[model samples]
Target: MLKPIKRAVHFDFHTMPGVDDFGENFDASLFARQMKDAHVEYINFFGRCNIGWSYYPTKVGYPYPGLNGKNILGDVVRECHKLGIQVTGYLNAGVHHEALLRHPEWSKVNMKGETVDLDPQKPFNGNFFRMPCYNTGYADHLLAEIRELLDLDVDGIFCDCMLLRPCLCPNCTKEMLARGMDLSDEKQVTDFAEEQRRKMIRRIRETVPEDKYLFINSLPCPLTKDVATHAELECLPTADGYDRFVSQVALARPLYDTVVYMNGRFQCCWADFGGYKGKAAIENDFYDAIMNGASTCLGDHLHPNGMPEADIYRDLKEIYAKIEAYEPWTDGTRFQPEIAVLSTVPKLNQSHYGVGRILGELNYAFDILMPDGDFSKYPVLILPDEITVSGELREKLNIYLKQGGKILSTGTSGLMPDGSGFALPQWDFAYKGKDPMQIAYYKPTFEEKDLIHLPWECYEPGILLDASEEDTVFARHITTYFNPGYDGTHFNFYMPPKGETGHVAAVMNRGKNVIQVSFPLFKAYMKTFTKAHRILMKHLLAELIPQKQILTEDLPITARATLTKGEDYTLLHVKATYPEIRGTMGVIEEHNVLPAGRTVAVKGEFSSACLLPDGTPLVIADCAGYTKITLPEITGYAMICLK
Candidate 1:
């Protein structure tokens, strides 16, 4: 789902040679023409990033106050905008030790209560950066400087810091309290951060055009950028990135898809996926993001210490050749579901039954979304075997449903609240009839208009393919294998062979809409038949309020996408991970050149033989078709010209 149509390169010109001793000899007009010639879509002029400094003039504050005439941002923006290359100047929100020294009151106190300076002692130990108090006078001053770019008709604003993770400072705590929240709990603190970030985005939105983007470099706390045109995350490969998983970094993909399905505002990711040596790994990470949802401004920093190396730039050019083709993958189907199901979550229903699997395999259509209240955003609410919604939320659900909105509650959906730790214990009691904790309960009625009566039972080695209306299923072509001769089937429900009873699973239909429910855990069950994530998705498409689901195959899996095509051609991504397991990968042939090897293997999976622009191949994982291909490499992705 990480495939994105729009991309921006962070031009870290910090170490670029000055035009003159007073910042002149660097040939301004000439370089602007050079940037336009680069054919780049967007370039964020590094006015100030990486630490306490400014590339442009500022009357409010100045570290290099002695600098004389020429200003960098003004020159770049003026030249680039005329050449059709959008420009957004950068501002290091945090990270320079020198800035902290200049604005002592703006500095942050760590857990040790020590003030940190953004500009550290010259040698650099990474210790100087700290989270500052946002409600302070310094932030106001910073905002004032940022205001200058808006006057220049900048395409967007690049905020280097101010993350979705909140600061535990006094101002932050006070603000949280004022917002009907607390700072003690982690989620609450996170919520507070998200809320504040949202406000930041709102402010930026208020400042620019609806199409302008905002790059909030906060990682874990990135949802605030949800409402912006596009958002950015920083340093996924760096020390503070998605802990280096680059692939599984979580955010608003699951939760926000309901609103901005594809090419929506929730598009953002940290460009910081560190350095790449090979053309393969580089293409791998790049396309993997495209397949998932977004690839906005991925950090391809050529140097660690700002020393731009020739070899690294070569790699960037090669990778860029491949990444540029991400546009084609952006035009497909859009999946905006309503009834989001809660998964193997730590909290949920405590008293259901059975050692269960196959909710989706059962052909149930439960919206695969991250439930974050925005539940109100959806008209009807469906609760399946997962767990019960909190009492307060349950009460809200009851109200919404009673008001004529349908509520699909099955299994032990409403058995109890979260405080009791009702997740597994309760679920086991309902599905299995007995738990080691001696928990037990009557199974939920499979009785519904959509489900037909069929004698079904689970198997030892394989799970059930028990899904209904197969035509509607999506990309269930999972190469994720369970080492052959793998003992123990996940869940196989013996069916009555062929009948209406055999086809339908649990379904809730309102005269207005129908919601299908399913539980397909491919990791637990090795058999592909048992995965009904698609059968349910079909229901989401035709029944649960019109949704256009795009799939490379007919079965559904953890990997999914929403592409905005035809109109502008963009791809939005949402991805998840599987338990430790690998499967045979698939490689599709594109391009005129066919290599000698049977296929390229990425992280062990055979690659799709499509030639990326730079000749690197597009390799998709066997498991869930996780993949990446250079956008320019594939001719199929070329923009179709209508007569």
Candidate 2:
């Protein structure tokens, strides 16, 4: 069963035993009332903290010494159950202070022959938490604690800090040797780490019931396919960058059915009394989460006295009220994607994230697809830089292309899976070796001629290919004078091109509509957010997939747009909020309002158009190939419905 966790809170209370009075002011009735007032439907309370202290009476693990035999978790769960608010028990998976004190051999050993509890170079301090190996006796203790937690009758269990790294501990080393795995090879180490993670997840699944929610935090990661039902992305915009929220959602949305963007109220993570962001910032974050088909969760830390912060709840009341109002259109709607971007490699793949960000910023509905995902629904497929074509994937692409599909590839995307050279008969291009120099310039001969920026830096220059006479040459490249080192910069900041004209930077086959670029455009844009690079990509996409595109008048690139369809109506979410750097972090400070004359092009036919939340009538017109609807005066976020 899917829990009603749309508007939720994550209470991270990693309190130490030195704090004597635990949950002294925890009035169960008052806490439940506060949560209800804040419009929270689900809450994740602590079962065990990182300090190895359990909140409830436990037979497998020691209880918090400061609890004085009181069951704080029991009280919270009992009251929340009465109020119809689901509770999820939270536990620290890896770190334990008490376990470190008892068994030193179980701790993780680094290359320096020292335990990872503290930096060996510094003096010994009592402030750091220790991580234990999962292949040792600590795994048994963890399973016992998980069994005790499940017996508490909570709705779910959220395990935190479950990381898998190469540990040099005695037990881990022995297990690696017994399994005949060599530690020197990085693939072997990574395989072992994944094995350990799978083992831990399997053990936890054996203990918890199948009906309950079991979330494991692996930081902006996808759900372990068969083991986890939902995926939670820890999207703290202040701690990390604000761009990560959208990029992470774009990556995880295609992998899991239930993806929650877990944001925190604090300015930073793990800060007990941290500063709160402005109200506009919080609302912007929630809107972004919902726009990408994800649930919303706010992170907070409970005080040592167990008293709910009155001001925090008051602020959340207003923000969550808006979310509740938008739930009708936000939930149970299918995202209508017209373009699919394929992921080539698993790691070190920057172009995948870069393409998603650019496409999202352009207000085009798209999804990031893995190699195995279905591409039949999408009319346009984008193969980003460095995607080598395997035999299996090559066959799939050939079939997709035969269905009159449009394709856009860059760099060495059409190369063989072995990374030796290009795979012929895949696309119309002859492999001529890579350019010796690093920096290059582009001059567009097709649309968007304003993208001609002189002396642009091409970090990872693509292997130059020969264009046929039947193909259309979109842009031509300009070779550089010298090769820039690994830093992607050269001593000559203003180096000129080798000549005014060079090889073709962009080309498109006449009949197939398959476009290829001579340089790594996505990687260059990722390195430097140049307008020229984006314009080049946008121009190519417009030529490839122009019939089905989102057309907005006078909308900035920061404004995001997504179109989704319900059973009877279609929702167009247009979010216009810009995050600027404030106090060493980027925060949404302004809720820019759009004028009444702004128009958005909708794809489907509808009888009527109206503003959401209130069915105020709006004028709609039938354009050449799209339905044009005039937008209202939107402040921060707006959802227009057409039926």
Candidate 2, residue 308: the lDDT equals 69
Q: Give all TM-scores, in the order shown.
A: 0.53, 0.93
- Name the best candidate (by TM-score): 2
Q: How far is 576's C-alpha from truth in model 1 (Å)?
A: 18
Candidate 1: residue 618 Cα off by (Å): 18
lDDT of 2: 0.77
lDDT against the true structure, per candidate, is: 0.40, 0.77
lDDT of 2 by residue, 266-379 (tens): 766555475777678778888888777888898888887877689888989998998898788777887778888887543325676677667876776777777888888889
Runs with alpha carbons beyond 4 Å of true place in candidate 2: 117-129, 345-349, 449-455, 485-494
TM-score between model 1 and native = 0.53
